[model samples]
Target: MLRVCSVFLLAISPLLSLPTGMQNVEGEVSAPILNEDGSLLIKSGHKSSADWESFSIAPGEHVIFEQASVNSSFLNRVIGNEGSELLGRLSSNGSIFLINPNGILIGPSAEI
Candidate 1:
């Protein structure tokens, strides 16, 4: 009985260690750009330690990237996954910049 149980556990352990890919994807930061031919270019950045940064979103995807320091003032709200309109507010000490009219750059002492 013990040998049978050990064999079964060993057989299932490899499956338990399977890579689902989401874990690797989670830590990646992506920037999307438009090519002259109208194709999409996605550049991935590694997750940073400071957490106060922004990147261009992939075209046609409903998503938002936010930083904790400026969450309340800069990125006040994000549109839902359903594709609703978005509204944002910022503090006097901070600024927001729209990069290429697509990406939003938010910072404490930056400009839009």
Candidate 2:
């Protein structure tokens, strides 16, 4: 006889929707730009021992992180304020760590 066990994890929070036609922009972390359409672009890169000292997103805005090329082990962490939405397209082995007290919504294009 063979048996299998399954485990499920659930997060309870309000539903947030992602914006349409978001684009990726590459740049340094300190100089983040908010486009005219209310979307924020994030450049692909790695930061070591970096804290969320000045990272924040406003309400009703969408943030998109871009990578030069898909790297399976790419990892990025962002600490956002309440009432903002984050969206990204990650590699199969990529991972993102976000800390938002209010809430967050993952877009459909996210593989992980």
Candidate 3:
């Protein structure tokens, strides 16, 4: 009887291990060097050059949005400016805002 019960339980074990139709998302990128104050050290590109860094993202099964282009207009404003860095955050409405340390908008502005 024990042998028969063991066989019955084994037959149902596969059902318990089935996936629930959930999938995972994962990707990787090169980590950047952060300053002592936790700011990223960005390397700007020259004219007619492409600039990029490898990035990793994990959005689980949900869709993840990638930025096609960083707002160079904002970065350009800081070309000769010192001690400026770009900071980004997601808004409650799902919009991305890049800000400077002083809480000023840092994207597409003539001044950084």
In terms of lDDT, which candidate is strongest?
2
Q: Which portions of model 3 show Cα errors greater than 4 Å?
A: 1-31, 48-111
Each prediction's TM-score against the native? 0.22, 0.36, 0.19
Candidates in descending lDDT order: 2, 1, 3
**Across residues 13-90, which tens digit of lDDT does each residue of candidate 2 receive?**
223333222222233333344568766554545431123322333234455555444541223333434333443332
Q: 42-83, model 3: which lDDT tens digit per residue?
A: 332222121222111111111112222343221111112222
What is each predicted model's overall lDDT from 0 to 1? 0.29, 0.38, 0.26
Report backbone clashes per prediction.
1, 0, 2
RMSD of 3: 19.8
Candidate 2 pairs with clashing backbones? none
Candidate 1 regions off by >4 Å?
A: 21-44, 48-112
Give the per-residue Cα lDDT of candidate 2 at 65: 55
lDDT for model 3, please.
0.26
* Model 1: per-residue Cα lDDT over 1-112, one tens digit each: 9999999988854332211111112333344344465433332323312121222222222223332334222222222122211222222222222222333343343222
